[model samples]
Target: MIYVILLTTIVLYAVIAIAIHFRKALHNSNSHQINIQIFRTLFLIVSVNIGGYYLNYFQVLIIIPKLGNDIMAIRKWNQIVGILLNVSAASNAPILYFTSTEYRNAFNKEWQTIIKLLSFCEIAAATSIEQI
Candidate 1:
């Protein structure tokens, strides 16, 4: 169940990244009729992510919440899994930025900062989860 949620969230994150890519592609060039096929593909991807996220969210929040406070073992396992999921999801941001030509061209050396931010977020999330 948790795996499903993480997988879906990862897919959604990819779609969102793709959307950003399309937006950048459009803005980068003056070319008209900027590829409907790409946009269509991105839109479909984004839609899938949206659906997956919601499905995952329902399973995590609603179903998990009902499990109550006594399920410490399950709760700990979920927390660890959630932390890993968030860390993995967040780690992709730097890759996304690097892959997007616009971002890479714009930031150049400073792109490392974006990566650093992702690393920081992952570390922070993991640390917090462990502390909990």
Candidate 2:
């Protein structure tokens, strides 16, 4: 179920990425070329991570069930794959933040707002505490 959904999403993303790549290729613009490269890199990262996750899922659900409790080695492999998958997933955000100008701009704007809100909250709390 979840595996199917993940597979479907990866397929759809690949299709879109390829379409964008071709579209960008036709234009020959420098920024579009850069964007296509970034898209390819992002696609590779996401696909690898998703594939790792699927492999981990298969090991846990299919391999473990058929092999029973005797195989300690498969269990170890499953744990390793799980850790790698998590690390890749964690890295995705930072990669996008650094690579995509739009994401960086949005993140910066949101971060500033968050900081301002936090500072306001702190001031309000301090004034209320002073009244007591």
What's the residue-level lDDT of 71 in candidate 2?
Answer: 67
In candidate 1, the residue pairs with backbone N, CA or C atoms under 3 Å apart (3 or more residues apart, or in different chains) clash, namely: none
RMSD for each model, in Å, please? 12.2, 4.1
Point out the worst 10-residue segment of candidate 1 by lDDT: 31-40
Model 1 whole-model lDDT (C-alpha atoms): 0.60
Maximum-TM-score candidate: 2
Candidate 2 C-alpha lDDT tens digits along 1-132 = 867877787898888777776663445678787767678666876776787777777777777777666668667767787787778667766667877888789889999999999999999999999999
Q: Estimate each model's TM-score.
A: 0.35, 0.68
Native-referenced Cα lDDT, model 2: 0.77
| Decoy 2 TM-score against native | 0.68
RMSD of 2: 4.1
